[model samples]
Target: MTKIVLYARVSTADQTIEHQEAQARSAGFMIDEVVADKGESGLTTRLSERPEGRRLFDMLRDSDVLVVRWVDRLGRNYADVCDTIREFMRRGVIVRTVINNMTFDGATKDPMQQAVRDALIAFMAATAQAQAEATKEAQKAGIDHAKAAEDGRYLGRKPSFTTEQFQRVHDMLSQGAGVSMIAKSTSLSRQTIYRIKDNPTESAAALASWGL
Candidate 1:
């Protein structure tokens, strides 16, 4: 029997595994198992390196259907994501994304269909990677602009957490703590922890804006 597996990743604490599974379920996938990597940055971590991610790769078998929320959930690197999906397809595993209901299958015998499928995968992987880079650049630009204004006195919006709290959150993140765990330890919301982890400079600027 063909089994269905769901894989989810959250770079920040705010994102939830349930949400990803829900999306897959809504797309009509009868998931048999779920593998999730929480608070792990796709940009920095390869799929093979993640704890749950590694298990997902090992658990997948021929005829198994692997479902994800989007291509980015696989990895933020274009090459890595494409390579991983292709490897799965090569093993006769069908990979699908809930976002666009995109399906990749290696069972196609037609050359033209294979070419089209390969092209789409490349395009989607590249687009996902580009979007991640663009977001990082935009965040950096916003911080730079805020720093330049008011004779470098404008520090952007005020931060919700204190300096000590920010430092603790940073330490926890550096030590590879999970988002939920860090949020609990710091007594801050998951969203705030995400903001701190994703853009440290912006977090600092916000703190400065509040004269913290």
Candidate 2:
């Protein structure tokens, strides 16, 4: 029987594999196995370079389903993501995303359908690369700002939640959990939760600024 596999990449210390699994389950994916790589930056590292990621290429068989949170989870590089997805499709593995429920299948014989799928693959891969670049730039700016504020003139307010709490909030939000529920579960105020939800990169920057 064909199996369903979920691949998760946790690049930060506070991130957890369980959170990704939960998100997949909440998205109604009946996952048969999960492969995860901790501290692997999708922007800098190719999927084939990751230990578990390499296992995915080796283990997945034709007709199997491979799921990810987003196309970005495959790789943050445009060419890399495109190549990886195309390779999988060529092998008859159906690639799906939990976030948008997007699917890329190679089984279609219709020329029009093929054109549409290929176009979407290109667009999503390019968008993923662009977003990754933007995030990295944002992080660099945040770090520079934090360093420049060493004089104590503009240290900014200390973050209210710890790194773990921040990660929990992020994970819950991605799972489409209620803000109030997440706030209560994380023991964080609604305002703080909202702030985190509104701009998670800034929230992360705040934590990094404070060396949290």
Candidate 3:
């Protein structure tokens, strides 16, 4: 049987291991192996620079299967992701994703179908990359507007908890507090904690995540 390796990533350190694990599990794969690189984005680094990508380069054997949450996880950018997939397919490694169950294998001998698939993969990867970039730009615009509205005296919305209380919550999370403990201490629901873990860029990224 071919080995199946799963890779998950988040671009911010604010995310916790539990958050990503739950996503992968919900995607319906009993992860054989999970490799994650926190606080890094696939768009900013070469494939070889990523821990999971590097491991994939070395560990993949002919006919082995590789999986990720999405196509964006496979590349430095849209083009890079597509090139990597093609190379993996050429190496006889079958690539799959848990989200869409998309697969690429070297078994396709038809050139036309291969060309179409390549085009589609590139388009989809590029779209995802574009969406991420656009999101960043939008967040920048929002922050700028918010700052303007405050006439340089901008303060963030009054969070439910005081800054001191928030600091304690952050500290407790850092100190390995369980969700239940955090809930009891901060009085924030488990769901809020999970949301914080996924969209941890509270300074800017959280603004977009919260529809602000």
lDDT by residue for model 2 over 62-129, one digit each (tens)? 99999997887788788889999999999999999976688997999999999999998998888777
Give TM-scores for every candidate, taking all chains together and pairing residue i with residue i: 0.70, 0.80, 0.68
How well does candidate 1 match the true structure in TM-score terms?
0.70
lDDT for 187 in candidate 3 is: 76
Q: Which candidate number maximizes lDDT?
A: 2
lDDT of 1 at 107: 89
- Candidate 3, residues 63-113, lDDT tens digits: the string is 887777567666538778878888889999988875556787879889999
Relative to the true structure, candidate 1 has a C-alpha RMSD (angstroms) of 9.8
Q: Which sequence of candidate numbers ranks them by lDDT, best first? A: 2, 1, 3
**Hey, what RMSD does candidate 3 come out at?**
9.5
Pitting candidate 1 against candidate 3, the one with the higher TM-score is 1
Model 1: ten consecutive residues of lowest lDDT? 167-176
89-146 in candidate 1: lDDT tens per residue?
9998999987657889898989999899999999878777776665566446545656
How does candidate 2 score on lDDT? 0.83
Q: Cα RMSDs of all predictions?
A: 9.8, 4.0, 9.5
Clashes in model 1: which pairs? none
In TM-score terms, which candidate is top? 2
